[model samples]
Target: MLSPSPNSSKKAFSRVALVGKFHADGIEDHLKDLATLVSGLGCEVFIEAETATHLGLSGYPTKTAQDFAGSIDLVVVLGGDGTMLGIARQLAGSNVPLVGINMGRLGYMTDIPFQSVKDTLPKIIAGDFEADTRTLLDAVVLRDGKEINRALALNDVVVNRSGISGMVELAVQVNGSFMYNQRSDGLIVSTPTGSTAYALSAGGPILHPHVAGILLVPIAPHSLSNRPIVLPKHSVTVIEVVNGLEVIVNFDMQSQTNLQSGDKIEVRQSDKTIALLHPSNHSDYKTLREKLHWNEYPSTF
Candidate 1:
């Protein structure tokens, strides 16, 4: 496991922020219960402005992500990994630790279940929890030697065919060295944190969250020889559209942009890291076993 940050002991979560997915079933009740439970612990609680509006609950202070990051000591995300990913990107460099409550399917990152919130929140608020830091990816799109779009992703960055029905050609380069030129459906450049996400579906290896590496997985490559490769965390990967085919660049499945031929996409490790707080008993291997239904059957006589 990667060493915890030196400032982990300095975290005093007196001001907490609540972020949730809008229009999700049972979210309002969960939010209400979470707010009451948090306030009972003698901590000031704030809600994300949009979530607050959606729930139609007034009187509690609400703040945008940018404003909330500056004032809140901790952020409590009440949804699945997708919601956490959105907030993670927003609060990347804020240094505000995040605790996730699992309210959606496949809560790999959001380990805390709704039933355990009552028992878990107090321990976390008291600084009696485990802190795991995860790396993020910074992706930039360049066209004609000029920067066009940039975004951050907690999971993987994907470059795939957009509107066309056929495969596209993409030239790959790493650290100024040519890697490969292939015709495939797309490519996934994922961080260790994303190994179990979309990358896994593409046959990429599952890298532990603490691992300092990036995964390059080809999406349905036409060539049988094409395979996934793990690169150094600091390596800069460049992908250029070679066939003038229209392609889409997706960031953690959250944001996307269209790309034309000759456009270059660069992905690298970001300096910012996400501080994820988990219950003391939380285990990554256990999560994988349960979520992925691995080794569920015992040996039979």
Candidate 2:
């Protein structure tokens, strides 16, 4: 769960779209069940094109992920965080809030559980939900001061070395000011929404979603003093590859682009954002305790 916005007048969602993790087991049956339920609520139900094709579902009208903007009132994603990340990026800045029904392990972003979606989704569809807006990272690859590649990431932008390569050397700068030069396996520039993800796994601190900051975490730094740091939300970070072979830059680990020496990766907070809708009862702290297993200890102690 994310920190929820204030409760507002519930807006009726008459048009709803469903996206599923087609690779997940039993997805077809789950989508069918949801379609029936949405229809029962007197709403028009649509299936995302790729999802429909994979499941061989043809009974419902199909739309591309891009087409869902301005067309659907709400989008329901039935998958894990990976699936949600993909759709969230596609729908970023669209103002079409997304609801996630978790069907994967360690669902940090996909907080809603499938077992409870039956009892929960109806309320959300009727506008009884909390909305949380998350910022996005816009990154571009620069070679000879020319833009070569660009992408938006809902999580962190990672600059890493290949499997067979040793530590890469990166020169870091913030807002055009020199920061540091370091040799490490990689570097992670993460948003608060991604603080709990790969950044955390790389020894980065877990920042609350509402926190206004960006995280920089080094992976296997050659110098022990090269630790993680948090930058102001408005700051722009630039990392130049001064050394290493097969270096690459990844946007949320979903997409990747090979990097060469002297190539600069420029990252900044995007003007756009993703809006996530949650059950009214959602609590960020409670979710952390549950998903991160903070509840494993004796509560009575």
Candidate 3:
């Protein structure tokens, strides 16, 4: 249970949007229930177009993620962290706050459980919640000195070999300063918000979400001396494939693009931020303890 912040006023969320993972089991029912709940709170509900189509729903107004930019006040995401990450990237720079309802194995970003949605959402609607602003990374891929593709990520920008099963050479630089040249499977450039995701699995440090730093973790480095390094939030990192063998750049594990030998992948902090709403009782340490199964003892103790 969460109590409203002392300074929070009873501001209502009039326009809300519902987004969920496509084809997820039981997602239709959850979407229907959430729409009804939001309507009961005297708010208008808009469902994402793809989600509506998957659920066979038509009555409620449907809007594309991009179309909801100025119209939707808040977006309620139902699924795992991956689902939330997808929505977060779409809603980036829109300044729309996101509320996650957990329906996955590990729900780090999606803190609210499905059973608690009915209770938790109402409080959030009444402006009785806390907002945690997280930084986003802007990743751009340059080929032949021309901008090829760009995307925003809430987690990390990974540069790895695509089809070939061998190590690729990558020369890394930070703000024009040479960092290192490594032969490895890949490199994970993560924001603090992404420290616990793939970065942690690659032996990177677990950075608190509030930490103002970016992490560089090499994936399967050939040399044991290569280690994770944390850089300032404002620093720009450029990774050039020195000896590319069909490489690729992945953004938050949601979108990816193939890279060439001379391709340059630049990662930097974006000016936009994501506002994540959480219950007042939310604790990062508790989430870590439960999700990671840490410090559990035997019953006889």
Candidate 4:
């Protein structure tokens, strides 16, 4: 585990929000402790509406994640990676900086573990943490070359079928150049930050968040030669539905839309970026080895 950054030399007043899985045991206690910890550092702590009810603290009187992001100076997410992703997608257009505190197993985005809260809190409250900015993707679906639906994803945009009969065929292209006509259950266009998510499950490469690239990995490719490819971050990729099969498009984990044959999805780097509060970015390779146990050696001595 990484150590926390030290507290800031100057005091600062900031609005902070806590997003957590209050259903988890001991989390309420931790929330209270965390709130008090930051409050003592001259920051105002805010809670989500229902989460406050669960914790018996003051309800925030708001429901949407945008409410918190639009109001606060910083957002603190105390759950697993899923929770952080959920919050990230919700606050996508709002451009909120997120600080993820891990309360679950195998958290890559949620770097600060529950045990490290005491050390991490003081520094984060004092604005001593490092900030890593990760860009998002803007994905829009079109039918007959007419606009239909649009969404933003911090992770990846997935196009898949719920049916079981035949594989979904996707015509993949990058900036008007044909990549391949792929036959698979789905297609994943993931950001480097998302390389560890569903893309990784589909045999995609693990890309560092700082890497300026996007990944297109096929899910169960029909041809043996179809391999995952990384594209320049600024490249515009296009995917069209083929094979006359019905499919669904997902923006990160939210916003699902149905697409028929001839529907097109254009993906590219979103103009905005998401800022992450980091204790340090010096050792993600270490995280890959330690937290994930990437490639361990047997006793050689």
Error of 1 at 135 (Å): 0.8
Summed over model 1, clashes come to 0
Regions more than 4 Å wrong, model 3: 1-11, 296-301
- For candidate 4, write residues 217-287 as lDDT tens digits: 99898897889999998899999998656688998866789989989999999987878786753357766
Model 4: how large is the Cα RMSD against the reference? 3.7
Candidate 1 structure quality by residue, lDDT tens digits, 116-204: 78777778887889999999999999999999999999999999987766898999999999999999999999998899999999999
Clashes per candidate, residues 3 or more apart or on different chains: 0, 0, 0, 0
| RMSD of each candidate relative to the true structure | 5.3, 4.3, 3.7, 3.7
- Tell me the lDDT of candidate 2: 0.89
What is the Cα-based TM-score of model 3?
0.93
Of the two candidates 1 and 4, the one with more favorable lDDT, higher being better, is: 1
Residue-wise C-alpha lDDT for candidate 2, range 198-225, written one tens digit per residue:
9999999999988999999999898999
Instruction: Indicate which candidate wins on TM-score.
Output: 2
Q: Least lDDT summed over 10 consecutive residues: which range in candidate 4?
A: 1-10
CA lDDT of each prediction against the hidden true structure:
0.88, 0.89, 0.89, 0.79
